[model samples]
Target: MMKRIVLCFLLIAFSTSVFSGVADDGAISTGEYDYGIIEWNSRNPSLVVEGGANVIDIRNYGRLEVRYTSIPINGDWYTGGIRDIHLDDYSELLYLDGITDILGIDENATAELKGGSINYIDSMQNTDTKHIDLYCQSGWSWLYDDEDLDGIDEIVGITGLWENDSAFTIGFINDYTFGYDPVYMNINVVEIPEPATLLLFGLGGLALRKRR
Candidate 1:
């Protein structure tokens, strides 16, 4: 009886794994990113289609980092609010490089999703003004509370493709810390079942049928 149960479980697990796909090695590249769509501006940035036009639906990636470049500053700096987001004349507006799996918790932590600005880090030039936006399907809220020394923006959601409100404006979150301005943002992308992680499900069903 126990042997039969184990075999049933293994079958279910194998089926799930086969149906679901694997994730990338967290590689950051300037290629195409697919997530039920063939555009780089999808709400599910972490989820990518390995091949064909199918959505993998990845949830391991829980954060999206928005990066900004300032004059003469190298590497990434920390900014609490929008007061530090700067722009220079003719500099790049903003672009989405990649998504990560980092969650903001009021500490100096690292994230998987990281982006860099195209503009040079020279003090002679400064940024003008540019607004960045985050979007998802539904069931999410964008909250701003930079008063208690916490993170700048917080995205809350239950499930099913959620994005943030891009109407907050750039003047609110940009804040200068020192010689260099902060160029990173940590957006949360909660966990969801991907097609690549459904192996054990099939086994459970098979076991029930055999017993009957």
Candidate 2:
């Protein structure tokens, strides 16, 4: 029981309000970029993208903790290859303590929704949903609006009970009638506790397996 407390602590500590690196170079505004990449085992084990990051890439076992920023991953669609926060291999993404423009999961990657707000999230169009394993942090979580009233529910617009009695919400809009993209969504966190204090992934993988 004691061990459980510690793991939850580590996983929930969202944003230090600082960044370790910005795209491995500088950042780009109102333009295109190769995007920031945290790759391989050679680089630091973790990178905090609190700000100064437009888009990001997490490959191999690198970890990306994002917050307090807007990250747009949908690139020039006509050119193809949108790397809006691509996750591959055993990479992990932890959304905590802030709002991000959007996130896209690809390959055998994993994402943990613990605190932060995510404007949008989806698996790569070509990959199975499981390819990018998504886990809701420790709490009560469920999908909303099963359009056809089918058993299938979406994680994109999730809602539920969080620790500290705080609540998180994700809203979506499909307004193609106005000649818009027709899809807009995000997790808006009014106020989430300072990480660590939150629970571990509801599925309990790395945290549960780790030696306390």
Candidate 3:
């Protein structure tokens, strides 16, 4: 009876800790703008910022996907659009899987990629090619350019745009109209476990097995 009670209590404690860990993973904020949905997935999480300046600060996450859209308010397509997007340095070891259009914006509208080390950037649609500016200090580096092929272009590289720094900033315009009308971004983060934490987990497992 005592063993069963102890086991039940341990299970409950473990479950609570697991849920708490997941709950404290990331954060979402719309500031003063009325954004869309901010969904979280254990494997992949995303944020959608619409029509106005917004900021996303994710300290740690598996992957971060951002869909930024800016539309004209009351047919004012010229002025009422996404002003800028700033990805701070808190997001480390970020990875991007693929690019999918999230929302549509005006042709004259522009978006900026600031901070964080982006492992991969899949595709961009409706963005003005001329306004895409990469900051060297932000560690935004293009590893490989497969522009000659017909399939998806692969711009792969280890280092970012700048040297030493892990984060990068790039600005681009939205120019697509048809199916590719929105800006989509995929970010990946690789988590490295600390040695002390790993050892503690192993010891705990061994203790539980012995107890059973």
Candidate 4:
């Protein structure tokens, strides 16, 4: 009974954390990306960004498949790839939080759930794509140049998602060894305040300090 209670409490805590909001100081702008699955014909990988719904999808080529969409992006497209694959080069990690569903959430949060889709191509065959979508009003935010994983940074994308209030089907598939795992449709979203914004904040802080 104690273990059950603890498990339930842990689940609630995790759920709250997932649904909580972070400040919008460095929030990622709203955007969506979708890529229709393609046959692996030795062509270089291509990505698509859908602005209406704000999602990102990666199409791979194998039995293993994964799709990440309805993620917000504050920076360029290659940001997620650069951070994930080139971690040695870049010292920052991005984050996204306050998401209740793939692209939308209930009113208890700031954003409304919207409909979005993402498609992932299976690696085993030449043609395998998973159609996915995400939608939200204000549930998404991002952080950049984050060296700390203390949930201080904004979110760039989501991982290991299975289901939620929205009707998006998400999960992981195992079809290969370490070298051939399902890849991520990484969304690299970074937020940097403008010089003027920073200056204004600085001035405000100085004023407060003087008054004190």
Candidate 5:
């Protein structure tokens, strides 16, 4: 019951990091940033089908340490929010915790998805290299959704297949030292059986179910 209460408040506090609102704006070509809210712009940048779009472009030895809440959950009247993050030409993007939409990683670029940005990191041009799962994220839920009424599910964990594939779990119940953690997922997970567990849910059709 205590965990439930904690998560409820956590969700409310974390809502602004994964979804709507206006955030700080700026541009970085060189220099290293470690703290503070960096929207880079009040725009939600989305990646193109061809791969490698840019909003926060890291190049020429530029480095961004996303240990805290870097990309704020935001958008503006001009249809702007953090849509794409690009790392190229030996630039670096070290992510520890935060919600990321789309990332374009090129040759000699470094985009390490550690703490929070684990599920949404994209290696736009580095499909050949194998990606290592640095952290073991536990206790999260991955659901299937096709809100467009199309045939595609939004919860694809397979790398690079959908550009937003999460290679790790999304649960972070105790990731924050403070009460205000800005890296939590927007949705709440109540209870849902894993697909493998669902496959063995006895002969009784009503024995197993999903409750969000």
Candidate 6:
């Protein structure tokens, strides 16, 4: 009986350690927006969502860090090609930083400058008021555009134009994909607890076990 109890305790501790660094899937809204950390650990790791907007009106409140690896392309073309990632005018604030070599915007994509401007950082571009094409496998790009013209910038939409054939998969619990297959990429968001809270919980568990 004592051996079984010790084994159960060990299993519980191991499970907690494995799942402590995950965040939950974020939401996109036109009215009230939910803010949290978004993480993708598949081909790319450490991706976060800051905020943005669109006709649907989804927004975020932090910065997004994207790590890239290999991008998927269709047809007999063995050589890698550029993939276009588009952000609409609804995005209030767009800031992006990460590896940019594997992904890039299609050359034919259009950019419309309305009121604000775009700031390019290394390979990444930051904009507060511009619609542009995003290219992969470059360096890093940050976009700081706002749709509402409000002082705060937020991410409004992750889905690009349907005509452009730009679709990605994001899951809060399990893994899900939207467009395309061969299952190239996936984003997983897991919740993370504060260190202080975790420590206190650990102590409480120990105390309860002792009493039992």
Worst 10 residues of 2 by lDDT: 180-189
lDDT of 4 by residue, 1-212 (tens): 99999999997775444112211111222342212111111112222111221222222221111223233357443222111111111112111222212221111111111322322212221113212223332233322325636765433333222123232322222234534323222222123344456789999999999999
Write one digit per residue (lDDT tens) for candidate 1, span 1-212: 99999999997776445132223432122222222211122233432221221222222223222332122223222211111212222211122331212211222222221132122111221123212233333344443444545655432222233222221111123334543223323333333333334446777788999999
| Shift in Å, residue 198, candidate 3 | 41
**What are the per-residue Cα lDDT tens digits for candidate 5 across 1-212?**
99999999987776534222222222321222222223331212311111111245556555655533334424321122234566667665656554456655555665555545433444433224432233332344454445736666555332211112334443222222433222222222223344445557653455544331
Best by lDDT: 2
User: How high is the lDDT of residue 66 in model 4?
Assistant: 21
Clashes of 2: 10
Candidate 6 deviant stretches above 4 angstroms: 1-144, 147-187
Ranking by lDDT: 2, 5, 3, 1, 4, 6
RMSD of each: 22.8, 17.9, 21.7, 20.7, 20.1, 24.2
**Per-residue alpha-carbon lDDT of candidate 6 for residues 60-129, written as tens digits (9 for 90 to 100):** 2222222121222342112221122232222222223211112221112122211111211111222232
Candidate 5 to truth, TM: 0.36
Instruction: Evaluate candidate 5 by giving its C-alpha RMSD to the native, one decimal.
Output: 20.1
Off by over 4 Å in 4: 1-178, 184-212
* Whole-model Cα lDDT of every candidate shown, in order: 0.28, 0.48, 0.35, 0.27, 0.40, 0.27
- Global local distance difference test of model 3: 0.35
Compute the lDDT of residue 25 as modeled in candidate 5: 26
Off by over 4 Å in 2: 1-43, 67-83, 125-141, 146-156, 171-212
Better of 3 and 5 by lDDT: 5
